[model samples]
Target: MKILVTDPEGYVGSLVVACFTQQGHEVISVSQANAGAALSLIQLAVTDLQNFDAVIHTGEICGTQALHPQIAGNLHYRDAMHLANLAKAAGVSRFIYLSSCSVYGAGEEEYVTEESPVRPQTPSATCKAAIESDLLTIASAEFSPTILRPAIAFGASPRIRFDVVLNNMAGLAWTANKINIPGKGLSWCPVVHVLDICQIINCILQAPRPLVHQQIFNVGDTNHNYQLIEIAAMVAEVFQVENFSFGHHGFGDRGLFMTFDKIHQFFPDFQCGWNPRQGAEQLLNFFTLTDSIQSHFTLTRSPYHRSENHLFHTVSIA
Candidate 1:
């Protein structure tokens, strides 16, 4: 199957490109290759601020870990949306948007299904939600548009986000010895291995159009959604650090268990085969590199800083 993957050098995009390319899919990188190739663009144009005072103030006021929303990369973000139309123009079989579960809002509730409403509080999520709405509209019987709401993704990529649950806990365990769980560690945090995400996209590419042609799948089975504490314990086991400990932690990016039963209604064997322990172990192996933003665990380069005023660098997946 032929696939056009945007941000091919990005964390999720790179992982997807590696996975599909390994699987023999004809792949194209719209972000890296040609600016004219952007399917749909995003607006992350705000440059990273240089003032340390501003970072501290924003952190204090906004309570976000990153310096700010990824505004510098907005144009590319916007172009990715056009990717769907480009895919159709290219006669591509499927257009997959690497969306996030953040659109579903933080933490779990009685009901968290695909049919649930999306409240995108943060800029990143807001852009994702908006683009998703645009994508669903251009889709139809002929053009297969699938939006995958993946749980917190962690795996080998250029931009590995240590901010996510499992990776964060693993980073803590690897460095601080105790995994920190905010607020009783009871809230559910749905997770999927980075490679598993690639597998889901590959499935969409391989499956008949009806299974995913214009459908949205919550890219994991019910077994994948786990509580924070449970996830931390698994990471502890991965490090062979018996009795690893953490307390209730707090963050604006809350998470919850998600029901992937709908996707399972089609593929029963769709479970993410990688156990949390194993996943944690894979990440923990890079303990020394965890602290530096250049850590080997990271999948995407931090666009927040640069050696020059130059803001954007392109990677072509032609």
Candidate 2:
């Protein structure tokens, strides 16, 4: 299959490109700059969009940039809609949108499902929810948009990110010999490996059109829902760190816990390949092989670092 993937240089997007290419699929990558360009420029830049079998949009403003409504609106919502419209215009049948599970914000329910009402708290989540709604509205017999709301992605990638929860804690534990848990570490979050996210996309692209058309699937293992403290402890154990502390106050973002039953029900063969411990171990190995130090763990050193603080943030790439 010929696939056009946006933000192929990003963390998840890079992995998606690699995964599809390895699977013998022809993958054309578009950077964020080109994707967000003027419509006329985009049309000229990416010619023959109709020839592609699918357009997987993984480009957006994430992390702190997503905190601002204007930035998130222009990049996440407006620009994304532009690309989707272009793909639709070009007769692209399968449009896979990478959304976040953070859309189910601040829920008290034990497990939020696809049917659960979206209560987006942050601008990022709000934009994601809005985009999902608009994409579904634009769905037609010729165009099928499948939304995958993946949990906070962790694990290793060619474009590694130390800003996420598991990665940050692992880096801290390795370099500083301590894992710092912001707030009381009580907030719940679901996490999935980067590789698993790519796998889920592959499954959706391979599945029958009717099975995924206009569907929103929460992408992660149902059993992977965990508390911040639990994640800290896991990192501490994996890195053999003796010191880990929690803050006195809570982070403003609401926790998200989701059920993956809908995805499994539709694609029974799919399963998350990596758990938190395994992801941590993979990071540990990465840090070891690279001889990563304290400076390497800092935000200033890595372009992939998104958060000012290394603790877990509600915002993440799918």
Candidate 3:
């Protein structure tokens, strides 16, 4: 199959490109500068998309603060709509949109399913919800659009990030030898390995058209749901750190418990390959191997890091 993948240089995008290429599929990778520029480029490059089997959109601006002015000012909604239009104009058969579970927002609800009413509180989630709704309307017999709402992803990427919950705790344990547990660590959260999400994307693309057409799948396993303190304990164990201190930081107290039954029913073969223990160990090994434990702390300490101090901090909000 021939595939057109956007944001190939990004963490998940790069993994998607590599995964498809390894499976003997032709892949066209492109970078979307912004909504307006991306639309113009797509028009100019329309002829190149002929006979393409699918388009995987994985481009969006992300940050630690969703309500931050800069994040709210991003063109993700426009960009995603334009990408869907591009696929339609180019006669592409499939469109895969990588969305986030944050669309459910924060509430006292114990569990969130795909059928849960989306209450997007932040501009980022609002944009994602808008894109998902628009793309579903574009789905037709010939054009299959699949929306994937993945849980907070962890594990190593080509573009490694330590701003996420498990990774951040592990990094702190390995670097500063101290783990900061924000809040009471009792809030529920769902996490998935980056590679597992990539595999789920690939499966959705390869599944029977009728099975996934216009379907929304929450990606991750139910067994992977965890709390903040549980993640911290796993990190400490993985790093073999006996002495760890915890403090209450005002950030990352909110949590969303996402359900994954839809994804499991759709792709029974898909399994979460890594748990918190494995993911924490992976981060610890990567940091130790690169001798970048200190680097992780340094970069994540200030304005350079864009990841929110939570489980669902970094991801493509397509």
Pick by lDDT: which candidate is best?
2
Predictions in order: lDDT: 0.58, 0.79, 0.75
Weakest 10 consecutive residues of candidate 1 by summed lDDT: 52-61
- The per-prediction CA RMSD against the true structure, in angstroms, equals 11.0, 4.5, 5.2
List, in order, the clash count of every candidate structure.
45, 0, 1
Instruction: Please give, for residues 1-318, the per-residue lDDT of candidate 3 as tens digits.
Output: 998888766667778888889989988777664332233333435576779999988746464235573454346676678778877888888899988887888744779899999988767778788889989998888888999898877888876566567767766676556677766777677899889988988898878889999999999998888887788788888877776555554434657777899888878888999999999888877866665555656654443222324432232212
TM-score list, all predictions: 0.73, 0.86, 0.84
Candidate 3 lDDT: 0.75
- Checking candidate 2 for backbone clashes, the offending pairs are none
Query: What lDDT tens digits, residue by residue, belong to model 1 across residues 1-318?
Result: 545555654557667667767887665444433343343223212221111110000001111213556652253245555445555554554566767777776634664788878876666666677777877788776666778887777654655656566776665565545555655666677778888877766666667777776677787667777777688678777765564443433432345667888877877666686767778867765544544646455877554322221111110000
Best-to-worst ranking by lDDT: 2, 3, 1
lDDT of 2 by residue, 1-318 (tens): 999888765779889989999999998787665542222224432356878899999856454364577675656677678888888888889999998887887766877899999988767778888999999999999999999999888988877777677877777777668787766787777899999999999999988898899999999998998888889888888889888777644453346677899889888999899999999999988877665564667645554232234343332322
